[model samples]
Target chain A: MTHLLEAKFKITYPEFSLDVDLNLPAKGVTVVFGPSGSGKSTLLRCLSGLERAPSGFLKLDDQVWQDEGIFIPIHQRKIGSVFQESRLFPHLNIQGNLLYGYQRTPLVERNLHLDEVVQVLGLGSLLKRYPEKLSGGERQRVAIGRALLTSPNLLLMDEPLASLDMQRKAEIIPFIKKIKDEFETPIIYVTHSMNEVLQLVETMVILNSGKVVNWGPVEEVFSDVQLRDAVGDGQLGAVLETTVSEHDDKFGLTRLDFMGQVLSVPKQNIPMGKKLRVHIHSKDVSLATAAPVGATSVLNILKAKVGKIGAIDPNGYSVDIELDAGRPILATITRKSLSNLNLQIGQPIFAHIKAIKMVHEMDT
Target chain B: MDIPSIDSGPIWLSLQLAGVTVGLLLVFATPVAWWLAHTRSRFRVVVEAVVALPLVLPPTVLGFYLLILLGPNGWVGGPVQALTGSVLSFSFTGLVFASMLYSLPFVVQPLHSAFESVGKIPMETAQSLGASRLDAFFTVISPLARRGYLTAIVLGFAHTLGEFGVVLMVGGNIPGKTKVISIEIYDRVEVMEYAQAHILSAGLLLFSFFVLVMVYTVNRRLPVQVT
Candidate 1:
């Protein structure tokens, strides 16, 4: 349960320089979220042993991949990676691509079986199709399957869904979660989308301008007022992990427990006891000066307190409010709402959020 | 004018020679082109210089050096003869060797550029999936660089068909053995058979056009993204 993934490096090229100090988990997914050109992909390259860091150590599960005097070549490192583009071999059919990695990993200590992988990835029907023959999402699924069959101790995915449309992105997320659920293999997922970060990862490493801005649990990291530098102004929000309380067939609603508030949304297929994380955008939330009865506008009412107010944008100011029960929430209202409700730092308020505003679907 | 009249024997022999030369060149050129694509060697310029030497050097000059290397007195010939139990001098084997070297530039340039245009992510992704170096080359790099390989094959075959000074020096135009179409055409013209020479030359011209058309057609079919 305890393992350390540490790296410190300074890379100087003609056009760019990357200098970073990173400490991430040796288990679960540590999402590297940042803006473009922030060196997120470059950082993963150092971990994969594809890029040499003259003076650093990359050790995962007792094996030192690179150190002061020794550098394990990329071929020797037991790391698997997926790029923005699904780099499946065009010459090979889906089965061939999957087997390409399976054959490379030795029989001893193989964590996954070929059949299980095909089933989990839903790739059984695709085994005969060529890489070019599959759609964008199906190709990415094959790419993920190909990487997982290798039984890598560490997985690095650089914007795995960047090229896909929103619908296609929604398609591959559950497959990724299946890997996380089944294996203890640490995954380093690089992405810029806040929705992806909230839905996909529990731990986060926020990177900006070739530096580690913050690193912690996904919930705490996003709730941090300083995280504005990591996630852009428009994207700042709190990440909350909640369970499916019940599904109301009568109302076609799924009730989720968020900060002791039984928030209800349109019914989804997610069965009971399924854990899901969702990002409630700050702008979608409305705070009231006093609790009221017989209001049809808001689907959720949670007792909260003003945590901290961030910089003001053109129209309104965004406030970090902690749900009195648990979890932090973001609510943006005009400066008029702040004074009208006498909303100040540490003031008690009721946050009203609508369930239909969920940006993405959650899975069990 | 009293020499053996050029016939299908020489034409077939030349075709066989060019065919074998191109086939061998392709097999060897694949790895070389791949290396040129992926290797970060400081001496890549040096290797590139050597490969391009055949392009710049006069065919007779290259053929003369090759003759000396494969001839009895040269170092390569002795070891080669020792290994094969026969001399390579002035034979079909010698002609193939000369043609491969003579036509190498044609194959290398096209394949090299093809591999370059293929970019590196696909190959790296394959290797990261635990594929061994060679496996990645064939499974990932080759498929991605296919256009380059085709370019290499067509250019190599056509270039071998067009060899002049090199074949004259190394192959020596033996009618039933080493003589190819170009050498056959040369022999016909030397003997004042303009009609036969014109027919063979026209065939060569048509062959070049056919191969060039194949290259252009395949390139257009490739997924070339225009900016």
Candidate 2:
């Protein structure tokens, strides 16, 4: 049986209101992606039972957490949450903070063990240190470990990386990825950063103005034109699922196979057959009428067909185009180029890929 | 310079009264302080004003009201006299009760500020970690608010130790029953016993100074302010 997390919430304040009805897969990472003030955090709070909506219904795989008459308080609902701030107990040392939830959970119910979590989060050395003594990254790692040790049925992260500087974010993202890989808990991650969304999302929910604008598989949602508009200009991109096929050690490059086509990226340590998700920004992809013959610096050249063309920008400088390269790939090009090339829907064309970022690697 | 021989009875009585009052006030005022820190109820302002009334109101005014209320035929004292058959006024118990009222804000304010500084995030984080409300309070909120508890205890105890007017109004200088250190000093001075009065007054002044110094030292050494 396919377990599902079903939620329906209607919350209103004088200034803003959130009305979302979501039926999400109860596995992997489901990223709630939106801009700030899109009610992302509020939605996560509702799921965790931290914010109670007057009339709401929620159920996780047939276990009802909240309904018209049945309401489980936050503690009763088996969930773990990591906030933007570490929120570690200042008085308790790292070990105490890690064991707090683990200790409270009934012995029979506890599945995640202390030693395993300590090793996973690399918190062995910090056990005796108080929160005030740890660096920001270390503190956030402990916070994640503390939450995970509860063996929650669902994990919620509300912009865990938002407070961190770039270096600190780099330090913590690997641990978050490791947790996702090692644990069986389904995660609902809320983030406004498209970078985080691309790196972590298995399924995506796009929220805007207190409602779900769209929700689907990562690729489909990224391909949605509405997402392009919501994400604004520079962040528009397509997510492609690919597999490592060959390594050119001589050229310091690795080749990936996506939908029967090959693309090369900067050398990766991942072995052959390992699946990876790569993000290609629309601005990085350019169009050509015919395949270039001579040594062009662009490594990826796929023969494709233009699938759809977006409206000209208000500034009237550029337009967003979608191409069918076995998978939907997006490109932003100048309107002058579009008219210059006489581009038409379903017209055969060549898509030059300038850059591809390796977002996430699937477990082998 | 001669050291005057002092009667230690009033000192012991005062110490006992302060101890009992501080202990009882901690138990009773914790919930009040927590409520004041976190409650969004409209009555919060009213409750806050009531708790702080002792801070601004003259102790004799409070004592006169307490005297009327806890006197033999008064509202609280009448019921107590009938049930327990002991008068509340002019008793050690009456002194404790009055001191608790007199020193309430001293205890509640520090605790309230501490609870406020601890804030809702840690509590919510604890609850999300599967700790029950009561469990979170004990493990997270109480520990985080320890400094507040320290300041409250010292302030409450010291304030009760130095109280004069409330005890005089309700307990009426009954030796070994209601007469505390401050009242003993008053009696000594009234009887022209300058040396004994000087001893107790200087002792209280030094004690108050030390308590303030301790609170300030601890606060400075361990800064737990989150924002």
**Among these predicted structures, which one has the highest TM-score?**
2
Quote the chain B TM-score of every prediction: 0.91, 0.96
Candidate 2 pairs with clashing backbones:
none
Docking category for candidate 1?
Answer: acceptable
In candidate 1 the C-alpha lDDT for residue B114 amounts to 79
Question: What C-alpha lDDT, on a 0 to 100 scale, does residue A186 get in candidate 2?
Answer: 86
Which residue pairs show backbone clashes in model 1?
Answer: B14-B180
Could you give candidate 2's per-residue lDDT for residues A118-214 as a string of tens digits? Answer: 9999999999988988888999999999999899899999999999998998888788788888888888998888777767778889898889999
Native-to-model Cα distance after best TM-score fit, residue B136 in candidate 1, in Å: 1.6
> How well is each residue in A175-228 modelled by candidate 1, as lDDT tens digits?
888888876667899999876787777688888888788888887777666666
